[model samples]
Target: MTFALVRVRRGDLRLDLESFARYAGVHPDLVRRLVALGLLEPVRERGEWWFGADQLAELARIERLRRGCDLNYAAIGLVLDLLDRIAELEAELRTVRRSRPPTGGAPWTRTDSR
Candidate 1:
């Protein structure tokens, strides 16, 4: 995850569909397609969909995966899921490592002579 910074207008944490598309530099129809494909989740309010500012990061991630890996939406979804799982596992491993006492030498040591 390299530096990806998104600037949003202050005091506007939610964006309408069109605004969301514009901010992402894409067409609204593409946004709709993403929504249909379950890649983007928007909240329905008053029959209109609103997306959180945080979704910009998700959109960027989707584009990165699509371009970098040349993947379709469905494959992108699977890749994102796997990436998330890997991150979770890494965090868990860090936590476990921190909780355990360090061995005097390597983690694996033979206690029985051959």
Candidate 2:
């Protein structure tokens, strides 16, 4: 799929590309490559790329995938996309649970008599 996985955190301040790379503990060149690869999207402002403060989490996630799983950029992109989908599904499940009326009895009782 050629889908772009983007998650902008609400109320986060923006930083220029260099500043973002510094804060993310990665080289600016690496960030640029990731952006170009469609793995990350930063705003272009006055010849500079601007990123959200929330991208810190994303940077860390990318690093984690690289280090822990030894995944390349392409694989990281797919894994992150799947992770985002899982998060969205969990949020929807929580909303559905909240909207449902509470039952007097428990959801279910465990049966271990056997």
Candidate 3:
């Protein structure tokens, strides 16, 4: 529900494929593999890929899921999709709750018929 904002230095807003891989401390092949698997999405210009802060964060998240949960890439994709859906649902729920009128009692009251 909470997110941390990262500040990008001047001229560091976007990175080329090599720079992205170096910044992420991973092999270029790995990055390419992730892109192939649709795990990481980067902008392709001409014949090269350009990565932004979002890709970096997503790469870190993917690594964490892979290492922490010991899941394969396919399974990780599923987990990521589910997690994204959950986050969307949570946000919708919060918005709905905020717009709702407050009731200073139980959510439901039972009525008995004689």
Candidate ranking under TM-score, highest first, comes to 3, 1, 2
Q: After superposition, how far is residue 50 of candidate 3 from its true place, in Å?
A: 0.2
Best of the candidates, TM-score: 3
Better of 1 and 2 by lDDT: 1
Alpha carbon lDDT of each predicted model: 0.83, 0.79, 0.84
lDDT of 3 by residue, 1-114 (tens): 222223356645777888888888999899999999999988776786889888999999999999999999989999999999999999999999999887655656534431
Off by over 4 Å in 2: 1-12, 106-114
The lDDT, on a scale of 0 to 1, for candidate 2 is: 0.79
The all-Cα superposition gives candidate 2 an RMSD in Å to the true structure of 8.2
For 82-113, candidate 2 gives per-residue lDDT tens digits of: 99999999999999989988755564663543
Candidate 1 backbone collisions, by pair: none
Candidate scoring better on lDDT of 1 and 3: 3
Q: Model 3, residue 63: displacement in angstroms?
A: 0.4
Please report, as a residue range, the 10-residue window in candidate 3 with the lowest summed lDDT. Answer: 1-10
Number of the top lDDT candidate: 3
